[model samples]
Target: MTSTVRRAGAFAILSTLSLVVPLFDPVTAVPVAAAVLLAAFAVTDGPLFDLFAYPDDYEDGRLYGLITFVLAATALGLVSVMSSMSTAVFVGTVVLVGYGNLAAAVTREWTDNPASHAAAFCVGATTAGVAGHAISRTLTGDPVTDTFPKIVFLAVAGALLAALLRDILILYDDPVVMLAVGFLCWLLAELVPGLGATEIAVATVVTVAVGYLSYALGAASVAGMLTGILLGLLTIVLGGYSWFAVLMSFFAIGSLSTKFRYDEKVDRGVAQENDGARGSSNVLGNAAVALVAVLGYAASAADLPLLGEANPELFLFAFAGSLATAMSDTLSSEVGGVFDTPRLITTLEPVEPGTDGGVTWQGEVAGLLGASVVAGLTYAVFPDVGLVGAAIVVTAGFVGMTVDSLLGATIEGTAVGNQGVNFLATLSGAITGALLVLAVAVL
Candidate 1:
């Protein structure tokens, strides 16, 4: 085979050998791990710095050789002065960077191809998993049961999802941004209480299963599936299974409605691409408001004193309102388009089907029905809120739907895409719900 392939194989073998050393002789594993990692760096001819250069740009290996030599010498020099923890951190950094270099070198050829990028992603994921587990082992002596390991698992899993999806989703245009989003989502999930080995395992399994199911059903693209996994896990873990049921109902209603007049929508040139399968932006736009509410609710439950006494009522209202708005807007557009011609919300004049800001009596009525479903379910969760709270949810949802139409007709495509419109509408619904509850409490 080629020289690079041979070098990669050698490096992989060294890494594997280093990992197995712990099984044979635990005491010497540390020094041996350090040696193997540094040797892998040398064997690969310094893959790390090479990543900084263009893939086509060739460099003399001797320069990298000198740099590696200098770096190794410096690391050795610091060993005398560094504390145990400092030395461990330094070594860990070196190992991670070495693995990263290998991944970058191997995937350089397939940088532009989504499917081919998996090789590089696998390398990165393995590195992250190993480092995270090692840290957990150091701290708790049990990687499987510890806190940090679960966080690492979630982070790496989300990263893998993002890497597989970034090319297909406009929301994740930048790799850094996509990775940051995954990190943040995991961070929030970590803050939830009672997330130990069992919860983490359950969340992982459910995320994977839901992701696969959504993809298989053609309800979502790969990006949307990734987004769904993150959102669904948070909803289930923090909001309870009943709330998750309500969440799924919204997705079910939206997806089925989109398919009601799929062929006609395509003919009209107003149909969503990929047979109305949603993307990352669509998923985030619809669910992000509810996610915020989930985070707030969890924070309240965690009893963070700074939050000034957890307002559970406001949290419930926000969550219900967001779902209600999303369902209402979706049904209004999809189902309304199926029946009657629409009139511009801002004007008395009739407009063609699928026109922005267009609405019909049939569509508005259908939207109310959609909103009612969410309100009813939400009330079922909080029966103490009574029928008035449900009424408030439906009204706020309808108001948000109205705002969506108004924005769409006025300045949707110019200043914001459909996703942006949806997000704002959901936010509006949430705010309205929170305000109404506060008003009732004050009076």
Candidate 2:
């Protein structure tokens, strides 16, 4: 057998261990699984290592993958024991991870075509969804239709996410992929119960269509497109179409700003890499915080009260603030790079156009405009927020953009990369917006 086939077969067999979880109590199952993994790890460096090792795996990579797979199963088991409704979800996650890996491995060995590999992964995930549902029905004596749509949705989403993660992470991609798929399946199973079939169908269709269009237009790479689709689906389903519109508004603004003076920016060495085509890092840096806000909004709507009282308003403000900050920063960098000479934000010393912490009047103005556009759309979509909430978003955006510049000047190059700064800026924007809303409420 090829090394790929060996790896795939090993994964499938190991994943099947999850099936025995129901026989043991959850508490015992976790420790037993952990012990087994520990034993395997201990022996990995010994003479028996080749039995479980793949030829292409880095030192201990195969063991790491096994550990992650076990962790995923453990998480699912815990969720299953805690909630009666989640048992099937847990089973579905295991099946999807196992089947998806198996299929992807076989496809990789058969052909070098990226599209074919992706198709195989999705097919495996979908098949797992159906088979898992059947197994769950047999075990729990539940009807076949119970949570069927949700299982399928989670499976496909997990597959796409795994594929995206595989592209981005080089060292521990397989492990991360498995862990991510498991978490996604768990999360969606809990949250998606409230959504109707039509709503889910709509979100999926819109997200896929938009993702494809963005890729086709060269605004996003394959990984970026996948990240966008996943984030877009969650946003629309949890926060509503209006929320998704706001996200798209940010994307549109950012894309346009990047293209505004493409040749000039390129000539000046300030252009985004790959002709401004965004990748997974760019998408996640700008939108991960926003996605968190969407999750908060969903939890609020569901009245889970994970964070005190369910305050959808606060999350909404945070969501808008995050996007506003992202747009502001993007426009400031792109437009400011072209229009005016920049000065260091810290000392007012003349600096290169692309210098860290660089500031320009033209850029600041463009940033403000970008913030306002997002804030305005927030008001239009969610009129309940009123002018005060919109104002908070704008203020948060400006504050976050300034913070980005400050960080860029002081510690960006040494302490953190550009993406790290972007994440922090968006996080600060989210916090600022939330605090403002709370202050207004207190008053």
Candidate 3:
């Protein structure tokens, strides 16, 4: 087909997809987009923008885009295959995972060897998560639920039109790219281990709501997209689940504690919110452990060993524990940021909110109370957990808070390539809590 015809065809297909993908879930559409992007990249040179519009004029842009497309596809494809993953094994997995990892690598300013490592880690970790979540969810007949792909594409299309009409610089921070990344991340989380449909739904709601609120509040430039995603998820938790209510309460105490010389952290705008999302260590760390636990359950219940049915109770218990830890840590930073007064977590010295080892009086007190509330309320979701499990959930929050602070102070966001302390901290807390209960049973 002629170039004009091909481009026209692509646009037509994309338009059709824009309409249909939403109904089936955007994650499913991601793969096809990725494939098309790859083909476009193959035909281009270096930069991404130039590739779609004028590849001949920008060979460098076309070439770079091609490289990225190939590498992303290759990396995600291999990881998915290696894990023998189920949920994300489909084409959608390749597209979303590729897009997500590519964004992370791109944002990290990865180049040469570091680029490969970033790709490897991002794709491998993501695949592991998908494999783990799928194993358990499928076993229990629960499916991953989300529609971010369509939301992102439509947002991008809208953004592109606005940029074209305004004749402004529609440069790097393209809405389309962000939408793609966000949608991809949503899919990854759906298939993530220690994750569930409930969490996915909560995240989607939070992102949309917060995005709208930020716009209403006039945080248009900074809050319109990504911030909205974060807030949307938060809203879902606060609005839909009692688990978040308690956690938010505890975080409020933690933030307030800093004012009374409890913990000091000089609070700011961006750091106040993103420190948790970008810096959390528990995300990937605990996911690995959850995979094992859920897989074991899946193997047992299905009577097919590796393909066994999942015991819903055990899976729910695991999911709640994981969600509890993540929410607890996130709420801590958010609530803590509400207060101006902050203290050092290590020595009770006053420090910046962005500073590691810093705490706040209001944040700490509120954080704890919040955690206890989440633990208790989350337990109510699954009768299998009983009251004892409730204690474990609350305890995990405390543990997660301590681990997150300690690591942040001592290692997080500061280490050379050890950028996962927060994720690890949360993971540590959840797995520790889960294992503690499991160990108690053994004894």
Candidate 4:
């Protein structure tokens, strides 16, 4: 038979074996399950993905790649379910949609080239929109999410405005970042370190409003978005945030910072041909991690035993620390970028603005100020411990920033690179924040 026929035959088999995978993979599949599954399906059945197939010369190799993807996805999906029943189902739905498209794209004879990847992404994007609609419904459930709808609407809408207002607004990255960080905030909850979804959503909306108003109003150079997010979160802690403060803070800072030091552009490094799709994947990672973080937050917010009840102060400290870290990171990156002479953090000598471990007077000050902003907001939320918490967060955040810089400079794109280091950066930041809060409270 022709190679085309053979390739088509393999693809068809992959679609059929979709269910059979779970049996062998009841615990875990082979190294590259997704690609393996696809390849297996194709080789055994014929007609890949039921949508497209390999070039006559590259059929075998394509099958290998496709199977690896399937196996990985299955493993990922299962793990997601272990975390949250709802999340698992949600991810599963996405897989189902993707598979259906895989089928169509296959029968339609789509290849696993850039075009196919894009087609897959389109399917995923559509799935996200649908998921949002579902979330809208969930938010408005019989009992509703209570404060959620207002929070989501306010946060998402607010951020959009901020992006639009900026002289050089980056709507995609900021929102995507918030969306990503919000999710990361969720995952951090697994550490029993937490930030609430309500607060995050509110922070998001408020940040947007603040950023946009700052920009549209032509006020601050950097817009001080982190200032707005913390402020918004603080308002929520006080039961609800007022828009007036958000707008005022962003505007005041935006307008006041006339000298303008840092360039607030998303780094060129972040730019890639497949950035949109990669960004989308990162968002997925965010979703998983964020949900966990949200769980930790909800536990605390609701005064639950394991997370919140253990030590309210500790939980509070965690939240403060995370916020401070985020703020410091943002401010440092933003302000530092604009500095005329950034320097090495360790040496205190001049270096490039975007260089990891590099620091500048402008950036350091920005970092300090950023931590202070979050700390101030923390005070506004729970006045009794606000100052202490903020101080802890500030110290921790700056340290985290320094560590992140070190990690980036030393290993991020280099030979010593490791994912473990990234986690360590986060842990050190949280620990720094937590320790500081505890130390002061002891006094």
Please report the candidate that would top lDDT against the real structure. Answer: 2
Tell me the tens digit of each residue's lDDT in model 1 across 219-246: 9876777677777777777777766877
Better of 1 and 2 by lDDT: 2
Backbone clashes in candidate 4 total 64
lDDT of 2 by residue, 1-443 (tens): 67566767777777666656544444757777888688667765543455456554355445666666677677667767876436666666677767776787788888996656765876786677557755765666676665566656776687778767766776335555665676777776667655467776788889988987887788988788888888998788777899999999998889888999899999999999988889989999999999999988887777774666867888888999999999999999999998557999999999988999999999999999999999999999997989998999999999989999999999998999999999999999999999999999999
Worst 10 residues of 2 by lDDT: 44-53
TM-score-based ranking: 2, 1, 4, 3
Best by TM-score: 2
Residue 335's lDDT in candidate 4? 62
Comparing 2 with 3 on lDDT, the higher-scoring candidate is: 2
In candidate 1, clashing pairs total 0
Model 1 residue runs over 4 Å out of place are 1-127, 130-153, 164-186
Ranking by lDDT: 2, 1, 3, 4
Q: What's the count of clashing pairs in each model shown?
A: 0, 0, 66, 64
- In candidate 4, position 425 carries an lDDT of 52
Question: What does candidate 3's lDDT look like per residue over 1-443, in tens digits?
Answer: 34333432333233233222323443555576567666665664333343244234364545443344334544443444345433333333333333333333343443444324333433443443344334334444555444333223222222222222112222322233323433444433333334344565446554445444433433332212332233224323223344333333333333333233222333354233332222112223423333343434434444544445544345434544554555556556656765666777777778755466667876677657656666776666545677888887777767777777788777766582233665576566656676767766778
lDDT of 4 by residue, 1-443 (tens): 44434443443344334333333333443344445654555563344433333442244434443444354445444554365423322232333333323332443344544323333433433343233324433533422245333333333322222222221333112223223322332232232223456555555555556544543443322323323333344334332342234224323542343224322333433111231121222212212222223345545655655763655455455555544554555566656666568777666677655676677777678867876775676667566765556567678767766786677666666643423343445456666766776677689
> Residue pairs in steric clash, candidate 1?
none
RMSD of each predicted structure: 7.5, 3.6, 12.1, 11.1
Which ranges in model 4 have alpha carbons more than 4 Å from their true place?
1-58, 61-295, 299-313, 337-343, 349-355, 382-385, 404-426, 441-443
